[model samples]
Target: MRERPKIKDIAERAGVSVATVSRALSDSALVTAETRQRILDLARELNYRPNVSARSLRTRRSMSVLLVVRDVGNPFYLDILKGVEATAREAGYSVLMGNTESDPARETEYFNMLRDGHADGMILMTGKLPPAGGWSHLPVVVALEMIEGAGLPHVQVDNIGAAREAVEHLISIGHRRIAHISGPLPELMSLHRREGYREAMRNAGLDVPESYEVRGNYLLESGQECCRKLFTLPEPPTALFVANDEMAYGAAYELRRMGHDVPGDVSVVGFDDLYLSKAFYPPLTTVSQPRAEIGHVAMELLLKILSGAEIDCDEPIILPTVLHIRGSTAPPRQ
Candidate 1:
């Protein structure tokens, strides 16, 4: 086998300087797109490989960001992760992953990895804050979840508005006694959504029945249990709005198990229009959060921090949400 080609050899063969070849290979700003493409083609032809470790040492960057989520398998988070992955790859960075599985201790352990420089930056998608011990001085942290005190900047959607919109959609279709299956109460996201539900009900001059709203953990089983509680009430709600898609599926499954037709006997709306929502038995109507865009924007903000760019702390970035109406929602039975 022949020896592997070096950058110098590629530069000589391409008739460009080593610096030009380097910029072309890395797709740097200095190299025009045409020049970069030509250099890249030559490198591919010559089978030249870059020494990532050496380059990292020279640049003092790992060129990687950490994305920590509670459940990596969740479809909503997965879409967001894909967005983050694509954006990071385009920005010439790799993504390091950490799964907490909702375990706070594991989350704390993973967070410690950031302090030791395991990743250039971190995108935390878990709702739990750092362990109540110490760790109040890390850089470039974004709370993609409802976690408070992340000690870094963040990007969040209007949970209140999104929830209100979902609820209002149900009401516009003549749903008065609508119930909400809420996520964890202490979480800012959940609290905001719950408040939105209450606010919408109050604004419409309807009685906000405490018993109609049930707390959940954003889990399937919690949703099922909440559904059971709502159905058992003396007066059941004709419509339900679940906090997330996973729970919405659970509510739908449980409702079907009871021989109730979705959007026929009851209408349902879910949040975080995950991929699963579209493919579900009856496509779920939900509030679509800019899942991947959230990840991309957070990473971009972190990149700005890494570049020593000053950001105004008072102004937090807020992404918008949309309502995706599907087969799951309709006018409640008159």
Candidate 2:
């Protein structure tokens, strides 16, 4: 049998210490760039491959991270996942994704994977944590949503302020009877957005009747159903602030089916300016959350935690959001 090349052979051929070869292969900044390149060339020439399992055993790390998302079908997660994967690859780490569909059992299964050393850390996009609390010992960073009192690090946008801004825009455009299609209240981000909507209505001296607020699952069908119910009201709203772009599309479709013209009889605003938002009829007016940036920062935070770096747990990283004005919004029809 032919013998496999080893790091020792590469180091000897490059006339560098074994530690230099190791550090260079690991992309360590401690090694000079010139020396690192020379060692890397020698390693390539020798076809020496490090044993990942042995390295993991030595370092007690799997060099892989897990990302838990509630719904993989949502386009909202695409950009975020791109950021996570890019950052992980640059750091010589791999990412494993789990779609829980908001199921507790699925969440628990992924948590067990982390505990069993399948991953070095986790970035949670599901909004909800595992029911069993023992996973707190693992390096975890919550992304896009916050779990109140969890004391876990997180990266998210100002849902409240963004919602308020969206609603305020509706109010400014003479939308006295404004309605909100909100996400499920179980998630803190949804709750915060609803509060912002209420705050905006109150500030504008507009009364938000019970009929004006409807719960949605952040899906198109939910938006369509909710919009239908709202339209049946004796006094329907002239504007809607939907929790997401998918729902906004649904609401618009339903409104048109009911013989109303967008921004002509009704105006619509949505959250998360998804890619399709721009291509939608009359282009959606929505809040732009930096999805990729949120993912990048969240993964970076988890990496820091795994490295035993001190972070300000007292402060959660809050990214800003922008309210985009588009053709979908205009003054309420006289």
**TM-score of candidate 2 to 2 decimals:** 0.87
Off by over 4 Å in 1: 1-50, 149-151
- Per-model TM-score on C-alpha atoms: 0.84, 0.87
lDDT of 1: 0.81
lDDT string for model 2 (1-334, tens) is: 8698887888888888888777776656577879978887777677676777788988888989998998888889989988999877655578888899989999999999999999989999888878868976788898987889888897988999999999999888788999999999867988999999999999988899999999999889999999999999999999999999999999999999999999899999999999999999999999999999888898878767775667677788999899999999999978
Which 10 consecutive residues of model 1 have the lowest summed lDDT? Answer: 135-144
Q: Please give the CA lDDT of all the candidate structures.
A: 0.81, 0.88
Which lDDT tens digits does candidate 1 get at residues 1-334?
8887899999898899999987665545566778878887787788677776887898776778888887877767776777788867755678988899888888888767776666777777776666575654555555546655544577888889889888988888899999999988888889999988888888888897889889999989988989999998899989998999889999999999988899899999999888778899789999998888898888767766665556655556889999999999888776
As a TM-score, model 1 comes out at 0.84
Best by lDDT: 2
| Model 2 stretches astray by more than 4 angstroms | 1-51
